[model samples]
Each structure stands twice: as C-alpha cells, then as structure tokens.
Target: MRHALILLSISATSLFLMSATPLQSQTEDAQSIRMNQVGYFPNGPKRAIFSSIHKSDTQKHFRLIDATGKKEVFRGILTKPEYWKSADEWAAIADFSQFTQAGLYVIEVQGGVLSAPFQIHNHIYEYALNASVRTFYYQRASISLDANHAGPFSRKAGHLNKSIPYHKDLGKAQNARTASPGGWYDAGDFGKYIVNAGVTTSLLLMTHERFGSIFPDGSLNLPESGNGTSDLLDEIRYELEWFKTMQDADGGVFFKVTPLKFAGKVMPADDPSLQHMIGKSTSSTLNFAAVMAYAARLYGDVDQSFAQQCLQQAEAAWQWALKNTSIRYTQGTKSSNYKDVQTGGYGDQHFEDEFLWAKTALFLATKDSKYSISIDDLPEKYSAPTWAQVSALALYSIILNEESFAKKVSEKAKVMVQQASVKILKEVMAHPYRINQMNYIWGSNIVPLNAILTLSFANHIEAHPVYLTTSVELMDYTFGKNPTGYSFVTGFGTKSPLHPHHRIMMADGIEPPIPGFLVGGPNRGRQDANSLKRYGGYPSQAPAKSYRDHTASYASNEVAINWNASLVIALSFLEHQRALSIHEPK
Candidate 1:
C-alpha cells in the first residue's frame, strides 16, 4: 500500500510538472514547456532551458534557448528525471545533466500542455554540497525518515570517512564567498540557517566516530577513531574557539552582522532580541548555552578557563536581565514584566524564541538557592502557557532542582507534549500541508520538538511515543529525505504575512522603506525605492504598510537574535545526543 501511494504521488507530480506553463511564454502551447534547468548568478543574467518531449529515434537531444529565441546556449542527451520530495509535495524531476551555471530554465512535453519555468538559484545546493563538506563529516551519516516518515537523527552506524565529506561540502557551499566575513551569507531575518549550520557541524563533530574528518589544511583525511570512545576532545576544542569568534565584547552574538552598510549599523547593541540569551530569561540563549555547556562536558579536555569565562558571561547577562526588570514592554501600561511585554507585543505569542529558552538556561547556570526561589516564585507576568515557555520551564525545573521541580514540570510537560502530539499527528495524517502556517511545520515546530527531547531527558515524563513520532515527522519534513530548501527574503514589515509571496499584493498602506540593503525579495527590483507604488504597491492600505514598516524596527533585532540563538541551542542538543549515543551501553 505504501509503495502504491508513493507511485501514485510520483505520477501526480509528473502530470503536474508536464501541465504547468513556463513564465516567459504567454500562449498555452508555448508555456506548457517544463523547465529542465534554471540558474541564477549574484549579478548575472538569468538562464533557463526546456527538455524536448519527443526524442528522435536516432538521437537523444537536450536544448537550451533564451527568451529572445536568438540564442541556443548548449544541448546534450536528456538524462533521467531526478526525483526529489519536499515536506508535503512530490516534485517531478527535469534533467539538468548538461548545464553547470546558475540561471532560469524550462522544459516542455510535445502537447505543449505541460510547461513551467523555475528560477534556479544554486546557492542552496552549493551551500549544502560544497562549503559544509569542507569543515564537517557528511558522507558517513545519512538523515533517516523513520517508519512514520519523520526524522529523529542521522541513520547508519558507520566510520567517519563517509559522513564528514558530505557535511563539509554543504558547509563550504553555504559559506561560499559572499559579502560576509563569516563566509556564509546571512539569511537576514531568517538567521536560523546560521544556527542550523553551527548545530549541524557540532553534531557531526560530536559523533566523529561515525563521520571522519579532513583537517583545515586539507593535508590528510583521517579514518574513524574506532568505536565511539575516541574522545572528541579536539573537535570540542575547535568548536569552543569558533564560538568565541562568534561572540561580541558585550557577550552577545548579534544574530548576523554583515553586508557592511555606510552607517555601520548591522545589529544594534540594545536590540530587545539580544535579550533572548538565557541569562536574560530568553529561552533561545539558555538552550544554546546549555547545549554548549553540555557539549563542553561531554567532549572534555576543553579549555576549562574558556568554559568558565563563558559561564561567567552568561551569569552576568542574566544578572543584568534581573536588574533591568523595569524595562518591560508597555502594552497600554498593563505589562508587569518582559514576558508580558513580549506576549502583548508579538503576534503568534505562543511561538517560542530565545526568551522562553533563557529561563531554562538561568536555572541550569545558577542552581543557586535564590535562583531556585525565583523559579518557584515566577510571577503571573510569565503566566502565559505557550508551549515554548512551558518546555523551557519544565527543563529548567529538572536541571536546577530536579527532585523538587520534576513533579510539577513533568505533569505539565506530559500534558503539553500530548497536546502537540495530537495536533501534529492529526495534521500529518490529514496531509502535511493541512496544518495552518505550513511554514511553521518547519521553523516554529522545532521548538515543541526540542521541548519533548528536554522533557524526556529530564525524566519530567515517561517517553511519550507520540512526542518522538511527531518530532521525527517534523524533522523529516525539514531536513530528512529530500528536503525542500526555503528561499528567504528580508525587508518585510512586522505585519507582513509570514510567506514572502503572500505579501506581494499588499492591501495595507505604504510604509517607510526599511533602512539598509534589502536582501532577497519578491519585488527584488523595487526594494530600494521609498514608496510602495515603486514596489508594485503595498499589500494592504498604503498607510498600513507605513505603520507596519515603522513598527518593525522595534522588534526586528529581537526576532532575529532570538531565533538564531534558539536554533543554535537546538542543534547543540541534537549533537549532544549523538555524542552520548556513541558511548551508550548497548
């Protein structure tokens, strides 16, 4: 039955691919061609091509043509379709065996009934296959989709040689020469990718027994250390050094700061987003710091002084948060604390970022009697029962004073985990895309998944089968199997729809343009202009755009920093788990 469903899906995808129209052609017949290859260069002309449906009996042919019909770039024998799937959708493969560079392309069947043009931006492929390969072990490890078609961890217990190459390639491509000193291009507001890269690397490093490595100088590729016991002391050491380079003097890592602008304004020092650090009650920071600390311990031989310094910095940050309690958000003056300020100010208030994660970090860092008291006496200001906050609190309780806090947190974690399990399972059963804010299944969904892992580790609750099932499912959707790469865009207003394309026809009024180099966008051409009309008008009332644009400035940094921090932590957790599994008693 499963095989039949898969076959059916493939057929439907093929039909869909063959039926859509290409962007350049207006007539149905001309448009029916599917794009075989598409490529985009940073500052070069877009390129595209179409596959010929009717192959000559004597000749297998491939053709590349420009929009003007004046140029036929190159052609070769058509190759087999490259099959790949995203979270919810199956894509029919068009062969791109002939082309090498990036640009737009198209493919068509004989009837002219099926055609589509895709904008091929190889940056994603390059990042995943090139840059990541250099630094980490990728070839040995393979992400697995479990029975439920969800991802829990990379599968295959093997030597390092196989896995490290794949990851190193991906890292290298992702960090391919761009405008940032960090090597990787920042995803701007979607800076989670940066965290993802770091986390992925750390995990690979932690499990070095399963993934081999090539030294930075590329002098030699080493074999697996044999067994999982070859202490990842060196890998941990490197990670610590890498992390230090990521930090700022004030002890905060700006989510991303590059593409240097004239004002030298990247991420400002006082952005509320920086508050997501754990010592500051931001769940995101806490989670990352906790993972880092955990990694430090597991790897051992880490620079203890450096580790202590980081811990101290974290402590100071938390102290600052506690001391600066008066800087709460003013939602018409009803706010009591920063939590209230965040919930009232942000839409989808339930979505967890760094703030909620920090609570757990604080508890872990201090373990002091007063901190425990604060945890118990957490005021109504932090009363919101969002899953993120609940998860962080649950983890914090278990980590700080496990015996005392476990009973309550365990009960709560169980309830929340059950709820999320039901919600996610039902959605996946119905169809992956059936869930609202489909994107959330990838980005926001990670929070609940991490919470489940934390809760399980804390013994707050028995291992909930559903929690694992759902988490695996979400992971599979985003990073397992044939993962779909998300193209992120910046410059949207705070009120802008989460999906970039959705905001194209803004009904809201125009707002002041965001200050800086607007990265990728739907209206990539019009980002520099001051007025909405120049950018094909606002999605809503012109005034609403202005209002949203202006208001966006206040929360942008917080959103970026918090999300990035959270991602790093989540990745760290995964890496830690992998490391532990290496030495787990069989």
Candidate 2:
C-alpha cells in the first residue's frame, strides 16, 4: 500500500510539470501576407497589399523587387499597423500605387519572403475578368468540350438528360422522352438547382445590364462568341434555356435535377449516373417567375421572340404561385425520393419574400400598379441577400425604378433605400472585419461580397465617397487583411488554395486549382466530419480563424456557382468604375 501511494504521488508531480511547460514560440509566419498575384496600375484604382504582422514587428519595411533581375524597384514603409483583437495580431498595409511604370514586380518582405509576381499594366484585370467569367463555361453540363473551346481542360459530354419524361402523376408516362438538357453544374457536383440558379443568373444579368457596352462581342471566347450578340448575354441565355425546361405544363418549376445520391470524386464526363428531375415547391416557382420576368426585359431589344416567350412563361408561373401559395418542399413518399439530403435543398419557409421578389420583377417588366401596392411595408434592413433570403432583390428593383413609378410607390421606395443604407453603414462601422455579419456560417465569404454590392448600390443613389471607401476596405478583407491571411480566390493572390474542393481540378492531376474560383471562406459550422478529420487536431473555433486550405475542408474551402457570381459582379463593377475614372480629367 505504501509503494502504491509513492508511485501515485510521483505520477501526479510529473503531470503537473507537463502542464507547466510552455508552448513553442508564436513567431509570425512568412506566408502571412496576401495580394493579387496579377495586379494592375496607372489606369486603375490604387492596389493595396495586406499582411498580418506581429505587434512587435510593426516597424518592418517592405520592398517591391523587379522579378526578372532581382533589383529593387521601390521601398516603402508599411502604414501604421492596426491591431485586430480577434486575430491577436497587427494588420499591415502596403500600398504600391505609386509604382506605375510597366514592369513585372514582386513584393519582398523581411527574411527574404516574396509575393507572387505581378504586372503593372492597364489590362491586368481584363485578364482576370476573362478567366473568372470563363470558369462557368468549364462547369457546363450536358455539353462536350474540345481543345479549341476549353483549351487543355477539354472533356467529353455529361448528363445528357435531353429526353426527360414527365412523372406519371402529371398524366404523362415517366418512360417517355421530353427534351431538357444544358445548364451550368451547380457547384463541384453535376447537379442543376433552380434556387441557386435564380440568384446566380440574376447577378449575371445585372452584370450585363451595367457593363453591356464595355465587354466586346467575343471577350468570353464561348462557342457562340461573335454570333452578332454579346458573349455575356449568350452565356446567360444558355442557362436561361435550361431554366425554361425546368418549368412544367402547370407552370411550376422543379427544384433541381440531381442523382439519387452524391457522386464520387470524378470528372463531370466520368460521372455516368441517372439524373432525377425532382420536386417543385412554391419558393421554386416564384423564383422561376422572378428570373424569367427580369430576363424578359433585358432580352427585349436583343431577341424579341425569346423575350416574348420569357414574358409568357413568367406570367404563367406567377399565376401558379397565386393559386398554390403556401407549399414548402417536403420529402413526399410519392415518386422516387427527391428529398435532397445530399445536395442543397434550397428550402425556404418564408413564402412572402419570394412573392415580393416575383412582384418586383413583374412590376419592372410591365408598368403594373398592382405589383406596386405590395411594396409599402419593406423590411427594416437588408441582411446581405442570399438564395434562401432575397428581399434585397425586390428592394433594389424598387429603388432603381423609383422615378418611373407614381408618388405613392416612389416615395416608399426612397424611404426604404435611406433606411437600409443607414442600417448597413452602422453595421460596417461596428464590426472589426468592416463587414456586417454577426457570425461566420457556411459560405461566409459571400457575406462581405454582398455588403460590397449593397454599398455600391447606395453609392449609386447618393454618390458618397465613404460608401466607396468602405467597399474597398471590405475588398481588402476578402483579399487578405484578416486572420487566415489566405486569399479567398483560388489563383489571384500571393498565397491561395492549391487544393480547392473541385472535382475536375482534383481528377485532372493539375498542379494548381482552377483560376478565379472563390472558395467559401472560414465557415465555423464545422459540420462535416471529413473536414474535421483533416484538421490536424487544430481546428479553430473562432469565426475568422475557422478556415483551412486542405481539400477535405469543404466547409471552409469549397467553391460554389452563386459565390462566384457575387465575385464576378463585384470585380466587374470595380473594373468598370476604374475604367471611367482613368479617362476623367484631373
């Protein structure tokens, strides 16, 4: 008994000593700064490179070096370091706007660290825009790619569900063929979802509406390029055609067409699985109506016949929504299980938002006072709109068309804009990240990007410099001002994710992930066990620190179509605004 007590005492003392030992030194890593690898200057807005340096190392200076010869192009001291309490470090800013001479340059920091090589030229972002927009082409389903069209990323066709037969319940035989094929895959998967497509298509259409004159006919290099219409509209029309196929004879829109189960990690051409054109709900029908109406007006001058078809379909869907208003997506036992637990369900319990969205689009398409009556009671503030919650779309349409409406409607629209702008500005000032979210959930990167969009809208209405400045600050956070210090984009920055959760890039044995794809940033949901397994026992619980670069970390690193749509819109706006600024007299 005495020997046992002596052993226990010794073990306790050893445990105490182990607990008292200090952790390893928390030195700042060299890969902590991120900036656009392909930069711009002279005719563009000022570029700011970001770093998270230790508080003790705040006085360090950085130099821009000529990449070809290792000669120093310029040296500049970093701006006063700002401490981020969430990250427990000081954020550093390095501005290279003064280096306007055309050259290939790399930013060099202390201890011989270097950023990715970048160029100072007028057309730098033009290349980025092309790459970003063409990424959608690579994600096209029911289509074949050749070397001429997709370059080295060519592959065979996938999911040619052209002969999609109606379900037996629709009074048509399930085995009979009905033509329905062609749309961009929703994400890393080869699925086509209506709710996700609605938001993505809206953003793309808005892009064309704003920059139609700027982009040339063949800029995107699609198969339909130089076809007497802008390539941007051509790309959108491809998806819009597929969207038409999703609507039933009853004018109801199906939620999605997906495999019965999630596919393995394989190329789109390799995934030879049966596709199920699944269930429809009120939200999906209303979303379909909203997108169709908006597209009808945009395509009016370009293709009159197609525009008229879109308007007819939009009216039909709106009528269907009016009759069956309260239906939500429930996994009915009838037919095959399209419950969609595997992919995104896109279920929205709030039917009012979709109703309002469809109403606004219909109002814009036709000068109908009936749609205007529904706009009296608007939401107090806008919460960075998404597929699930899209009231902001209605708000935007109303604000844009205020002048065209009578006093009763226009006055309400103006008041909603002012209230929303004040709310957004207040939130932007309060947050340390300079964005408006309280927590970082799944697809958190979209939060800041959406805020940038709202700010741009407000700036358009009032033309305040503060709105633009705040927008740029949010852009800085996205590029790399916060924790993780990694660019959210796959290939634009000094340090970016090489192993994105993209199946094509993974199966192709590529050296780097596809360019211009924006990975979902820092999702603290941490729900996937696959992600947790690859966390190396160091998963961060904090909202800003929850991101990892591993391919298995899909929660933090998966790229999605809707997220990229937001990015394309934001970046295109910047490029367009900058182009105008360049020609302005000083």
lDDT for 325 (candidate 2): 97
The candidate maximizing TM-score is 2
Residue 290 miss distance in model 1 (angstroms): 6.9
What lDDT tens digits, residue by residue, belong to model 1 across residues 1-586? Answer: 2323432433343343333333344454442132212123222222122222322322335455443342445554433322212222222223343344444445433333323334333231222111122222211111221222111111232111121111121123542231211122222321222233334333333234222222222211213222343323333343344344333344433222211121112222211121121111223233344444434333433355665665665554444444433222122244333222222132123323333344444455545544442333332332212323433343333433445454655345345444544555566445422121232221342343344334333322454333332332333222211111211212111112232211111211223221111112112122323544443442322210111122222211112222332332333333333222111111
Pairs with steric clashes in candidate 2: none
Worst 10 residues of 2 by lDDT: 17-26
lDDT agreement with native, every candidate: 0.30, 0.71
Error of 2 at 361 (Å): 1.1
